[model samples]
Target: MSEATASPGLPSRLLADPEMVSACAARDFAQIFQLAKRRGGFHPSRIARACELTPSRVGEVMRGKPKITTMDVIERIADGLRIPGHMLGLADRSWERPAVPEQRQPTAVARPVQEDRPVAAGASGDLDEILAVAAGTRVTPTMLRSLQASIEDYWRHDDEHGGEALRPAVIGQLKYVKGILRDTADPAFRHSLHGIAAELARLTGWTYFDARQHSAARGYFTESLRLAREIDDRPFIANVLACLSLQATYQDKAEDAVTLARAAQDSARLDGGTPRLLAMLYMREAFGHASAHDQAATYEAIGEAQHHFGRIAPSDDDPAWLQYFDHTKLTVDTGIALGQLGDATAAEPLIAEALRAEPTANLRGRAFHTFWLARTQLQGLKVELACTTAGQALDLAAIVESPRVVAHLREFRRSLKPYRHTPAAMELVSRITELGS
Candidate 1:
């Protein structure tokens, strides 16, 4: 590799990994020639001659970039000694492909003529009567559930259509539910409402964060905390706090993350013993300490997290939400903290183990682990692999409805720019940018 190929941004580890190098070598040179011909006006014959590959082989390379199985082709091309090889690998390796374009629905144009009309007498009469009757009925869980379901459906639709058309409806439903929850007097109803409110807050916060409207996300999270407090649902409260703490951590606010995690720990402590809650609290604290580069504190937090994990019993009657917290989850967090502490070698095995243990981990959890792995790979200068993993995470995050997942994805993208020219890294960056847009 020449000076140009040895750019500081390239992952240093790329040279050490036989698989990655082989993938580079086996990259299709045909695709590179075609792209060069189309974009740079390089003749295919010339490129083929330079790489010592037949024109037909060059063509095959072009078609194979998307399905290239070996990294050697890419490596050979990257070394700049093989013209056709360089062309093919470079063409498909520029960036990850953008998401498949969403199908657009046709809409009818409105007529220009407009007329204002008064409501009929019966319509006005019924409106007042209906309002009077509706005012007397208490807001029921069934009604709340209906609204919640509607919000969820709209969100799903938004995910498909970029959320433009459904955002207003989702926000409206959330506001209405919040108002109803505020006025309800029943304890059980309030508890259910609190759960609903936390979810809404998380979703709304995610929406705002996706829009880069951090202030709005902060407000929604604040409201979520308030609702969690109202019902005195300590476990749920801790969950909400964990979300907030993660937001701060991704924003590089280590102190804030620490404070929020400690608060969550205190809330969990009030309920006596809950292994899952303790694990969450300690994991969050470890993340904060890792961010701050406080190795001692990070290790201490990890120890606590491990202690909580050890406390879990097969026969314990844990809450439904806590069921996801297991040895895999703990290991994932440990890997994340270790990665942050600059121990990629130690971190990689832990992360791989976690992924294997929970192949179908929840969307948010998967995102967390993927982002951490990407970070670790990047630090070790494994640019292509880092980007690949990040791209996987972006796909997972698109389907996940959690603010915390979105936040982590955003951080992952930010961390990839140093090696943005690497095929995998570039691909990840483009995907995340498009998703945010």
Candidate 2:
């Protein structure tokens, strides 16, 4: 019921109005414009300022000359006007909250971690104070590139250290980028910003996914997808879809996972995405098929995945996001898909090779892959070896606070129920229990 104090976001009363809610739900911007004008003293110029629309565009919308269909613009309006995300089918905007007092502003602000150095973490009241003091500056290409580099750093840190600690920074940066997007007027600059925003959302969602927070993950993935569509970026769209598909697989929504993965494939194929990108999508599809218990379809998808991967050359212009999907990743994924089909004997060697080559920095990935390897080993009746492998996985998982990793380790422990009396099983169980406690 609180209004956005620093932002021009809607007041509780107007946002609560049935008619305003109806307009937002329908995405009827013209009606929204009229209502803001009538109820909130948001005249055409104010609406233009609040929503990041040109005055002419605002006029057109007011006259109902053009219906607003662009997702990015709609999102800007929603944030600027302070409409809650539920009505507009979005994740809650960073600005959607009660007004904070000036005395409390400094404490509420938290900046995104943009460099290698550690910084304090909090919300945008911090940004507002900074932007207010540095208002005349425009976003530079250098600035955008810097932000992108930070994203790559985040990915590296996340891979090695897990996502739990990075979650706050990731979300804070996402909110920051979105704030930058509002003030940036140049189309070229906005386009790049939108890409950053999309990637950031995906990363934030990924952090949530790592924590086994599927609902939060889905929301940010959806946000990323919408932002990608805003710029008609097919590769990014496919990436977000693939993220959703993988989340669905983890959530046990097998059929839905397949549907989402196929949709990602369609998007990836549209622009003739890089071999690596297509390969990753196919792997996701394979995961979905395997989860669905469709052995033949799973193998077919894995074949396609490898086919595309084989085509990847050094000169292939792959997106930065797909850089993590190298040969080791492909091998492990293939193993996992095979394991899903209950082919543990065949899956074992493949996973072992990949685990040996897995980068030391990729602790989380290594832990996850090791879990699958242990699963395969257990299925093949190598109980002692499985226990050893599971111990390694548990140690790695313990190093990084990943709920998904812990959950898998817990599941593996439960699987060891039959052999709980064995020395290897007893040792592993004791270690896991100590860690859990």
Candidate 3:
């Protein structure tokens, strides 16, 4: 593609070149790195930063000394470079879709995206119809099954779009489910209903957190934990506690964060949760430790997380919430931990890779990670480039109503104070002000 036709904010100067595009499509990272450095005037470090790899790793690839065999890494490189997905043997490119509006509720006509995983097919319709149909009928297993599918639909939508857009719909369904719990006379189905309620509460809490409503998020988390405890769902409790720990970390309450994270780990120590779930807990612990600036403890937690994660197999009976915590997410969390510890050299590439690996449909997540890249860029003294990167994140922030993004960007603006005298910095400040206005 020509520069004129390339996606916005992409490294078009490189990606627009047909030869480079072909190399990316072919997964020839060595050639791509070489050409980008020689012809594109990008340093190996720049390439490493863009690809989220260590300089040594980039050198190994360029020298053909290290095997570039991991599909995850290849996908990250492809994604970071904005290579067309079809060029990389993927079915679709993320940039093809426009930003989804937050207010668009799922309807009867909503169709599921075809993927390898199980999803609710034809689940785009409103739940009011389902409720209307089941008005006089008793709570049947089939009804619960349909509700479960509906819950999955909202979950998928929240992942694709930001929580702000899908919160109302999810809340509506949740309220309906609570009504069922109140009216249903069957004791046998109460546990199942409670399980779904806990899930709904957790999702709601997550959305609130995503939106930066910390108080509400914490309240919902508490409710979810209570419901999970009522059901004796140790795994679910562990997950919710981990979430609380994450919130605490974000809030800068390091001690509380660490305490909650450890509690989560202890709650599931008896194989009550899947290995992947335990790994997630350990990852949160790492985050807490990193936030507290405890380097040794941080790395230890990360190692433990990886240990548990390495034990996961395709047959593991993990929960739905654990689906997004794969190798890619682990890499992202590790980068964030390292970044928090002020190790920009070690953190930059990993953060870059995570940004590339983020799905286009997940605009909110992309925006959040992009902010991190800009933050890292600033720390590395790449002022002009950092502004440009921050600008891209700002564009995304304009489209997504995420309070977390808003908070992060504001903090980024504060970071630019030292560079306020520079033209680029001033211009960026002006743009950010305009964004807020």
Clash number by candidate, in order: 28, 6, 4
TM-score of each: 0.57, 0.70, 0.67
Among the numbered candidates, top TM-score falls to 2
lDDT of each: 0.66, 0.84, 0.78
Per-model root-mean-square deviation over C-alphas: 25.7, 16.5, 19.9
Name the better of 1 and 2 by lDDT: 2
Candidate 3 lDDT, 216-246, residue by residue in tens: 9999999999888876777778899999999
Give the range of the ten consecutive residues with the poorest summed lDDT in model 1. 65-74
The C-alpha stretches of model 3 lying farther than 4 A from their native spots are 1-137
* Residue-by-residue lDDT tens digits, candidate 1, 268-300: 777554776798789999999999999999999
TM-score of 3: 0.67
Of the two candidates 2 and 3, the one with more favorable TM-score, higher being better, is: 2
Q: What's the lDDT for candidate 2?
A: 0.84
The runs of at least 3 residues in candidate 1 whose Cα sits more than 4 Å from the true structure, single-residue gaps closed, are 1-129, 132-137, 144-170, 182-188, 209-212, 314-319, 359-368, 381-384, 387-437
The sequence of per-residue lDDT tens digits that candidate 2 reaches over residues 101-124 is 656445566866598865443567
